[model samples]
Target: MTFHKEDQVLYLMAEHDLATLDTVGLKKDFRTGYDSGVYRITHKQWGEPPHYAQAYFDENKHLLLFSAMTDRGFEQLVEAFNAFGHDFPAEPYLRVNLTMVTTANEILKKKVVLNEYHDLFQEDPDPESEKVLKEINAFIALVLPDINAGRTPGIEAAIRKSGIDPENARNVMESVMGSLEGLPGPKGKSPRKSPGKSPVSGKQKKLTKQLPAQSGEGVRLLSGDDELLFDLHLYGMAGDIRREAPWEYLFEDEVFGVQVPGKDLVYFVSVMGFEGEHQALSFYKGYEGLAGFLEFRAEVGRLSLLGLPDDGMLQASTMTGGLMTIPHLMLSFTDRDDLEKEDLAAIKKSGARFRGKGQWPRIEEIVPGHVPVYPSKDSLTELFLVVQQVLVVLEKDRYDDQYLMREEDPDHTILVRVPTGKGPRFRWRDHYLVVDPKWGETSYAVRISPASSVALARLPEASQELQLDLFMLPATVREKGSRAYFPFVLMMVEKLNGLVVSMSVLSPQPDLESLYESVPQRVLEELIKSGHRPSRIEIRSDLLFDLLEEILEKAGCRVMWVDHMLQMDEAIMSMISHLS
Candidate 1:
């Protein structure tokens, strides 16, 4: 990429598709013009470092654009867009176009015209605007026959004539351009439509009552009280939530304390033990009213808040327990009401098994519209697709302790945190979950870091060694062989966030206390000598907190403690003093 001052032009060309261009290339002839203050570059390329550059201007000489000179500077800009393989606008000038579109009419006009030059280069969609673009493109394709048949020449003109506000003209133009790509003849040759009857309308309807309203055909309404009252049952799911059922329905003095802007006239859907004994929190903060309940089984809670669309006929959200409750089943009422006797019987059986445990609320609390009922034969096939979109594993196989699953047989051998012996034994909540009768209860949700989940799943070693074993196994089997006993040990190690060592040291041994004392010294010496950073050391299970404190003190290392509770970090200068 090069910028010329005397020519008053910005030039961008790629060496090849894989080029990671860093520094801006400028000919020596243009250097003098720039040195003498004839011109400057501003916006840098993706891989370039920052450099002082003057702005480019249009024919009127009012600041038009700038180019970046340093490779590092350009890299920073590209990093902003390409981080995490996330979707981002491919055109380098997209931000510029957006700015122009919102700022000045002449600039906006220039941007649309420039789109013709760079249209082929554009790829990534704006997460916010993609749906609108999708709808527009779909509508255009649907009406393509009309366009090709000479019914319309310029859809942009038709949109303008339909009274589309000038502010939204850019979006209208994109839709028009994408659709017009398939039209016959030159730009001016197609049938001309009057700009008097705008093809695009002026303003989108106000979706104040919900999050940006989706373009899906119909709308269903329900009261918060209704969803709150329904007795939703999720059993045989992972987690210990059923044990916590006693905690779900804590009484609140007030009816509704929180308010969503568009949903002011709403009631609170309070589950007893999920929030606190008496306090109630909204499912996903402010947007609770847009959907019935915020369903958060995995890290889906975080993604749902960002408004990512789920890949089902419909997606639903509700709150449940963490690491100890059964997964809450989101029900859609449309299918449930339409179910035949056998299907209804199967649903009621699953429902009875989950809710009969006595923690589920009365049936009347649920709103009477579309909800996620029990998985049926047809829906089960699509279950994985829905599950992957709405649910994510925090740490892949972190549950190897409580539910060790075989790599060869995921469906057959995996022991999730669902009740084992049958009967209703779990409690559902908006935020937290509870499982009862302690023995067979399981967690509906679990926690794992996003970083660990992605990278560690690929290593072959993880698949063979990582296992989940229940800690609270029957006393009769406590002294069983390693095959039976190791699971409990695995559960303990996982709970405390300790690593399973290759040496049989941490594996259950008869003289446990003596085994523990000798292992740490050997491990610590080996770890330090192996050039391991302080952060990477696999601490001894029993000494996780204690040894961490000791080593930091011995090394005179300053440490920062970030609590999992609030996820807030605090610096500790001396571990000895802090521990004291």
Candidate 2:
């Protein structure tokens, strides 16, 4: 962790290599990394690194522990595994573990291990260790750097500033040196792996690897590869950039897409090979085209990303009732290349066998100038920058109210593009999972509501007044028992004296008559509990007014359909807001 002159939080990360496990070497790397960026360590023999340099690796997994100064740096540490960790010499990509510690001291005090599957860490912060580390940090500025800088006079000056005797400064310096010599290990490099002994190197030599090989591309948090974004050594790839191109001069909009790894998926991916990654890519999905992608990119590989497995894939979270995963081409439009007839035939044969199809996807078809040629390393490097700019949306959604604007809540709202086959099931208040095709684009509306607002609408305030009104709207029915039109109801229940209430999203049922009773029933119950029953319910639809009169008769509420009134329009606007 980079300790600034003033910082309260510190992070320690460990990247363990399962191929060549080293507990002692972990300590050396931590010290090296700290000194390399922060301290002026001219010689390691005389300078004593902090005790935080000490690290304990999992007994089962080969690991190295260290610290990073920033969140991006910490993330890059994990992304490192995805990048260069793929080198034939650095095999066992799946087993390499990078665990995060909240404080640098936790490396020694806490046990960070991977769950049996080696997907997530099974450790958290230790409270006592955090307290001790804070105290240690409070005084570290006084000694470590000065000692490494070989500034005895400066150290004495600092000590004297604290009212210490000037003469004891020599003794203090001696004590610090004594501590350095007393540290457990020798002050020299320790070889962690045997040279030319990796199992993968032997296999890499046998097979001619292909560039843009079937493996899905992904940026791991911060390995050397994430830092450089250039790893072109693929199976059988022969070309290298003869001379570096002015890739910096190219406009970002010129590129088509960037290659990315298999994103979040529910289906099992048993192997980490290209074939498996490609198969997962085949199942790769995207949300609302690109709007959701903008939000999803920032959260990739985070703990939140692991929440709610998206199987059918979210059309809208409202449509699916759970967070879903989708994909975008990490590979851009300019990714294709003009292929020689023989070369194309060989690749085509392989592509067909891999996909079990005679033809490729439209984007993969061979075309001369239109095809993207990424064989050169310059293109590979340019990819990172192009993708960075292309994937983001700079504009924030404009909103006039506090409600989660459908235009802004990327998590919930989806542009209702009509699905040709089975669309996402609409989750109505968490009871019925209606898979009605009539629930398509025309009548259905989606919006986000604060949990507090939802809770307020269900409160026990009898003083609050609310009314339910329905307007007949057509929903394209696709199920066995769906209707052409469904009643769209609106409820105007106020929230906490200051809080806004949620707009209820009434589902368009295949059977509207069944809901005709439930709609008035829920509204009457709300009014009775609130003790503010209105004299008459003003609905806009004459058909609904006539049917609602019979349904609401038992509740003792009068019903009438009005032409257009300004006061009632405001109430109905809240319901209509769901469409935006």
Candidate of highest TM-score: 2
Score every model by TM-score: 0.19, 0.20
Residues 1-580, model 2: lDDT tens digits: 2222343223333445444533233333333222211221111221122212222334344444433333334444334323433332222222211112111123124343322222232235445444444433333346657665765546644654444333333334443453333222333221122223322222211111111222224323222212211221110011111011112222211111222222221110011112222211111122222323333333333323545334212212211111122222222111124334533453343222112231122112111111222233332333333222221111010111211113233233221111111111111110111122222112212122334234334444344322334442222224454323333444443322312232344554533334443454455444544444455555544334544565454445555654333333344443335643
RMSD of 1: 25.3
* lDDT (Cα, tens digit) per residue for candidate 1, span 387-463: 22111211222222221223333222211211111111122111111111232222222222333323332222211
Q: Residue 265 of candidate 1: its Cα lDDT?
A: 23
Please list the residue runs of candidate 1 whose C-alpha ends up more than 4 Å from where it truly belongs after superposition: 1-27, 31-576
* Deviation from native of the Cα of residue 11 in model 2, angstroms: 11
lDDT against true structure, model 1: 0.27
Candidate 2's C-alpha runs over 4 A off are 1-260, 265-386, 389-490, 493-524, 530-568, 571-580
lDDT of 2: 0.30
